[model samples]
Each structure stands twice: as C-alpha cells, then as structure tokens.
Target: MHAFIVTGASRGLGYALCQTLLDDGYFVVGIARNAGPALEGLAARHPERLLAVNADLSDAGQAAASVRTALQQLPLPECATITLINNAGVVTPIAQAGHYPADEVVKAVAINVTAPLLATDALLSATGGLPARRRVLNISSGAAAKAYPGWSVYCATKAALDHFSRSAAVEQEGAANPARVVALYPGVVDTDMQSSIRGSDEVQFPQKARFDALKADGALSSPADAARKIVDHLVSPDFGRQSVVDIREL
Candidate 1:
C-alpha cells in the first residue's frame, strides 16, 4: 500500500487532502496541532488507514517526532511509495512590518519554513532513499509572489519555502531514485486563517482591503476541491521534475 504524510491535517486544506487521499485508498499519516472536528469525523470513517498525530510543527522537536511517528505507522518496507505533503502553515495577524510581533514572526518562520525542511529530511532518512516515483509537495501561497503591505512575515516565509522546494527539486534530481519536489500555491480559500486576518484591527494594519475583496467576491475555493487537484498533481505521470506550479494554472 502507498503511504502519504500530510501536515496540518486538522482542518482547512490539510484535512481535505487527508480525506481525499483516504478515498483514493492510500494510507495517510496526518499531523496537526489538534484533532479538530473534521479530522475526528474522518478518523471514524477510516480508523485503520488514518493515523492522526497531534504536534505543533513550530516546535522543532515536536515536528521531528511527528515525522518519525508517521514513518513508524507506515513502514517503508511495507509501502513502496511515499509522499510528503508539507501543508501546515500560519498567517500572522495583519500588521505593518515594523509593528508585527517578533514572537509571532518567529513562529511563522518555524512552522512555514523550518518545519517542512526538517520533516522532509527526517522522511528521507527514515526511508533510506526516495521511493519509486517519490514526491514532496510544499503547499505555498500566492502571497509568496505578491506583496501585501501587512503580510510581510507570512509572505517572506512562504517565499522561502518556495525557494527551498525548487532547490530541493534540483538536489533530488541526481539521486539514485529521485523524488519530484514541487511547491504548490493552493490559492486563497475560505479558511479560518482568512477569518483571523479579516477580523484583525485594520486601523493599525490598514490593509484589510485585500481580505475584504476576497470575501466579497466569493473567490475562495473549497478545500476539498483544492485538495483533489493537489493530489492529482502529486500522482500525475507528468509531474516530472518541475520545481513549481501554481494551482491557479492547473
């Protein structure tokens, strides 16, 4: 059986990805801060195939442990194919670059950038090498490319992740059994993170217009639909060695 690891699987896109993978008959190891209601429902449906691990990816040690638990649950010997979906991320409250809290920015970098790299390295070590047709998908955001005044930290971290994914793709290219690494931009979705950003005090940040427009235009994609598309790309024959692809283009 093929095995997949999806981080931030409690809700939003991560939860959707886990559910979709389960439907496709793949064993999934889901790591999240807490087992939210949506994930609890999924676990009830696929008790054997789903392994829910609660870990704060921002905590370096916890992040590494989560990957180890996932490996233990789905041994490399038993599953010849493995996929790592670094989907967990955080969007700090909208604040001007100079005014943003240092602690919050640190947490954002730890989870959005450092944790994914650590998790991928742990998986590679545990598996000994890349699996046949292995793939590592980093969930990124359009913010990585575009600049929004109050979202500096969030944008910077995602931009770092995108760069890391591209560089890792090149490193994996020469491996005896290479893996395709792709940084995927999932687009804006109607998620809790959006709500958090929208409800923040705009007077201090003065950049609520973008959030307001997203809500007014109903431009958010459903997590389930986005998750399906992400999975399709991961499993596609032509996934090839491309280092980056925006979901909007797919």
Candidate 2:
C-alpha cells in the first residue's frame, strides 16, 4: 500500500487533494491549522484510511513535528512507498515590499518556503530505512516565474521554493535511497487566497484589478479538480526526473 502526507488539508486545494487520495485507496495523513467542517466530514467518511492532524506549518518546529506525527500513524513495518505533498502556502495582504509588515513577510516565507523544506527533510530522514519508493512534491506557483508589482514577498518565496525543488531533486538522485522530487505549479484556483488578493487596497497595490478580472472570467479552476490532476501526476509511472513542471504547460 502507498501512504501520502499532505499539508494545509483544512480547505481549498489541500482538502481536495486529501479527498482524492482517499478515494484512490491511498493511506493519507493530512495536516492543517484547523480541522474545519470539510475535513471533519472527510475523516468521518474514511476513518481507517485518513489521519487528520492540526498544526501551524508556518512554525519551523511545528512543521517538522507534523511530519513526525504522521509517520507514527503509518502501519508497523511502514509501507514501501511514501509521498510527501508540500501544499501548504500563504499569501499575505498585498503591499509593496518596503511597506509590507516584517512579521507578515516572515510568516509568509516560513509557510511558503522554510516549512516545506523542513517537512521534506524530516520525512526523508525518518524514511531512510524504509524499503519504498520515496517522492516529494512541492506545490509552486506562477508567481515564481512572473513578477507582480505588489506581490514581491510571495513571488520571492515561491521562486526560492522552485529553485530549492530543483536542487533537492538533484540531491535525491544521488542519494542511497533515491526519491523523485517534482515541483509543480497547480494553477490559480478559486479559493480564499484569490479573494484576499482581489480585496487588497488598490491604492497601495494596483494589481487588484488583474485579480478581479481573473475571478470574473472564471479562470480559477476548482480546487477539487486541480487536486485530482495533481494526484494523478504524482502516481504516474512515467513521471520522470522533470524536476520542474508547470500545470499550465501540461
């Protein structure tokens, strides 16, 4: 059996991914800040196969601890294949880099970049002895490639994550227990994050208009549908050492 771990599973893409994985018969361990109604419903449906954990991934120690706790929930003689989905992310209120609050920027970096790296490290270390195909999937964004005037912090963090994913993929290739590492752009989904961006003060952040257009044109994909596509890619036998793939291109 295959076991997968997903972060930010309380809502949006993360929650959708959890539901898809459970339906596909994979043992899933989902982490989030709070297990809200959606997650509660998922747990009730898959009591034996789904393990829901609540933790703030923005805290470095808490991020690492979440993975350790999930590892403990796996069946004894742990499954031969393990997948870690670093899907949790944060988009602070839009503002110029200089005007953005220091604490908010730090929190965004922690959740978007630092936490994912730490979580992947902990999972790889813990599963070093397991005889399974190991995989790490980093959820990236288009912001990593393009620059938006008001989203400096978000763009920087995601760009950093994209490069980190490539570097980590290279390292995994040479490891004793090689794991496939792929960073993917999951596309913009209709979620609270989008609303936050759209509702930002247009005076300080002029890009709110673009976000509004995106929302109005129905460019936003459904979280559940995007989640299904992501899980499909993760389990594909032909998924090679691409390292970086944009869902838009696919």
Local accuracy by lDDT, each model: 0.84, 0.87
lDDT of 2 by residue, 30-81 (tens): 9988854548788888988988788998899999999999999897376878
lDDT string for model 1 (179-240, tens) is 77889888888888888888877875467877789889988788988888888988888674
TM-score of each: 0.94, 0.96
Tell me which residue pairs clash in candidate 2: 80-132
Please give the lDDT score for candidate 2: 0.87
Shift in Å, residue 28, candidate 2: 0.6
Highest TM-score scorer:
2
